[model samples]
Target: MNLPNKLTLMRVLLIPVFLVFFLIPGIPCHYLLAMIVFIAASITDALDGHLARKHNLVTNFGKFLDPLADKVLVMTALACFVDNQMIGVIPFLIIMMREFMVSGLRLVAANSGTVIAAGFWGKLKTAFTMVTIIAILVYLSFSGDFNSFSLACADTIDRVCGWILTGLVWISAGLTVISGWIYLRGYWKFIDPEA
Candidate 1:
């Protein structure tokens, strides 16, 4: 395996550690630690792609696994937040639906020897989603008890972070939908029933 591929694998490997820190209770500054791991994983995402393109080390394995690793990592974070009642299900569902649609489209295109690279909107969505998740982690870390902070500071932190998080989630979802549409529009030929 090349260096880029190794970084991709490292991102996947960090997911379990992220889960442990985010989900397990009683760990000191658990949210902060989880955020750090997540940041590390996110950095690998950028670094691997840059190195792959720069060094011509891109491989079929890297191509296949990189996106899968990204989706899994993001989904894990969103699902954890949803389960912990930090965010609602609507944005998660929206983002997830977009991903499923895009993935299905990719499968169809791949069947015909086509490869669709991610669009600008997709990249934007990813950036926003990562920032949003990080924001939530920061909020939780400082709020005292990830699950029960709202009860403690229901009037102040809860209201402020809630609004900010909600805005970020919706913006990410919007970008996700737009990106999915861009894919569908650009590749309609592959999935056109009346073609």
Candidate 2:
């Protein structure tokens, strides 16, 4: 396998490692370790694509697995957040709903010998989602230290983090809905039974 495909596979391999760090109890700085692993895996997502196009190493497997890896990594993080109460159940279901819808759309398109690639809005959603996940992880990782600050400072910090984290989550959720709409609209013909 070429380096690009290797990188893609490596990213898939790293997901479990990232989760291991994120989920394991009582590890020192495990959240930080998870973030590092996640960020590294995220980097490979871009690098593999860049190298694939530059070196003409793109393959069907890469095309399929690249996005799958991204979704798996992101959804895993979101699931972890939901488990930890960093995010609400409704938002979690919203994200998962969009993912399922898109996956269904893709399966339909594939059955019809068509490939519905990720669009700009989808990419935007992914970028925002990754950033949101990282921010939440950072916030949750150090939230315990909020008690160390003075009352005013703690309140200020809490307010700021709350606004940032909440805004990121909503923005990412909005983008998810938009991107899903775009995908469905763009490929509606594939989904139309009479056409």
Flag regions of model 2 displaced more than 4 Å: 144-152
How well is each residue in 49-82 modelled by candidate 1, as lDDT tens digits?
Answer: 9999999998999989999999999999999999
Off by over 4 Å in 1: 145-154
Q: What is candidate 2's lDDT per residue for 16-49, written digit by digit as tens?
A: 9988998885777788788889889999998999
lDDT of 1: 0.90
Q: Number of clashes in every candidate structure?
A: 0, 0
As a TM-score, model 2 comes out at: 0.91
Instruction: State candidate 1's TM-score.
Output: 0.94
lDDT of each: 0.90, 0.86
By TM-score, who's the top model here?
1
